[model samples]
Target chain A: MKIRHRDSDSGKIQLEMTPMIDIVFQLLVFFIMTFKVVAVEGDFNIKMPRMSAGGAPSDQLIPPLRVRLTTPQDPNAPVCGIYFGQRQLASFEDLRNEVAATVGGGGPNADADEYEVELDCDFDLPYRFVIDAITAVSGYRDPSSGQIVPLVRKIKFAPPRQASGG
Target chain B: MRYKKADNELLEADLTPMIDMTFQLIAFFMLIINFTEAEQDQRIQLPKSELARPPEQPFEVALTIQLMKDSKTDQELIIYGGEVMPLANLQRVLAREREYLTRTKRSPADATIIIRADGRAKTGVVQQIIETCQEVGFEQFALRAQQEEAG
Candidate 1:
């Protein structure tokens, strides 16, 4: 009996492109469908333990500066007035200036823990206004250098007011 | 005069460059594609601030709590794990989350609760959520905000 070998030298074997092309198209479609255009997001971190569990650190040089955000009687009102220690600030800009002045030209490596701001926000005041107040006190964008000047990073919310439903 | 083309020659379109380009595009998309489940709800408009830069280090464990305030009805809704609940009923949901964390061998104290709240949301409600988290043994929090566009 003679052993015969199969033909190993078959002419140029055509590459199968259909399945690969199909898979590639499928991936492309999947990626295009899931592509979401989102604005870059950031976080302002807070470390608040329960009041009963070791209240607050006492290494502060000064007492917490009280920044109050008040609103009109209307439930849907934005922040109407921002008072920094009894003195009413005209706007968030003024609040930022007031904070910068009080903190003595806060720099990049300023002692943030020593200076604290307690946000005493009104029950009806919008949360954005509180964020504005926080941004104003926490830091500011320096125009000349286009850098953030660190002011007070220690921010705490005053006790929650009466729940106004929303 | 009539010219006849050769019938034996097969006309073949070159697909190498097209496949190469397609593969390049796929590679590019894969490189830039974000797979992380970022909870960016459309209903809540984030507050923008110049100081709000992305954190340098990603939190090892994070739980996102979304809050939406209806402008017309003035109703507050707490959204967590794809379920919407009222603010008054959110403490129960938070307690469950703490349980889940512990079951998975993760300490609730190390987890950062990321709050993506509507700008119009009531501050009191937000504080209540934080307080609830505090009671549940989570101390860390991150107030999410949009990066301010330069004026």
Candidate 2:
């Protein structure tokens, strides 16, 4: 027996939207949930070509200014004292001020192009302090403009001090 | 009493706007997503610097070295190519990299060695790593840090 209803219009076939919508929502959720916020990273480029035979300090246009970071005798100290040239400094800020003055503002104030810095760090000093020192001598962010004023672009490391045990 | 059939009316809410909005949201998220984080290892807590701005141009050839040092135990380790080993064992890895570069007709001097070391790691260890890279014929180095906003 065949049944026909007077209220039905049966010619059109409707597509199912439920599964597509479900999957779309799932895709959206997956992307959103897996999304991460990563901090911007940067680098300090140091071009230290291998020293030629005979240990020549050759081809240096300007002698590098020495900045030594001294580790405290107590192995537990978090930061190191900075010795910029002959003057022993208390903080990285001091080192920055001294370097800025010595580098002088070239271009308008002085020539930072010919300037260089050689960092001599201790065997056990935390690496962060070295970066702090590098950040200090390399440049300072202008407080008002928030612009980074580069100081010495050329930075090199002195030979590592002897390891305490290993 | 007579009940009316609703199926003949073909009732459907408009879904076009909802789907359009969803696709827009997905596109926005896809645009902002950064895939470079895969190259970074979460184990190393990098040093922060306000002046550490990203380079204006990417290096032509780069090799990343992730260094980790246990503060309490002083056990240093190097993470490269997803492999971790003691710091003293890094020479072997560097040698392999140098060999690979030479075999591929690329010079080690052409590659910039990028060192991403933990903040708590020793400065001497970093220097030692540089020396090892230099010994491997790598002339260029990059010390990486997280960018901190000026305060």
What is the C-alpha lDDT profile of model 2 across A1-166, one tens digit per residue? Answer: 8886665565566788899999889989988987888889999999887682113585668788899998777655655888988899988888888998898842257666678898988888888888999999898877777677888888888878887776
**Counted clashes in each candidate structure:** 0, 5
Number of the top candidate by lDDT? 2
Candidate 1 lDDT over A28-102, as tens digits, reads 888888776778989898777776223465455688899988865764554468899989877888888888888
Question: How do the residues B41-103 of candidate 1 rate in per-residue lDDT, one tens digit apiece?
Answer: 778899887788899999999999999988788777988877788877777887888899889
Name the regions of candidate 1 deviating beyond 4 angstroms: A1-11, A52-61, A72-79, A108-110, A163-166, B1-8, B103-107
What DockQ was computed for model 1?
A: 0.73
- Candidate 1, residue B1: Cα displacement in angstroms equals 7.6
Give the lowest summed-lDDT range of ten residues in model 2 chain A. A52-61
How much lDDT does each candidate structure score? Answer: 0.82, 0.84
The lDDT of model 2 is 0.84
DockQ scores of all models, one per candidate: 0.73, 0.72
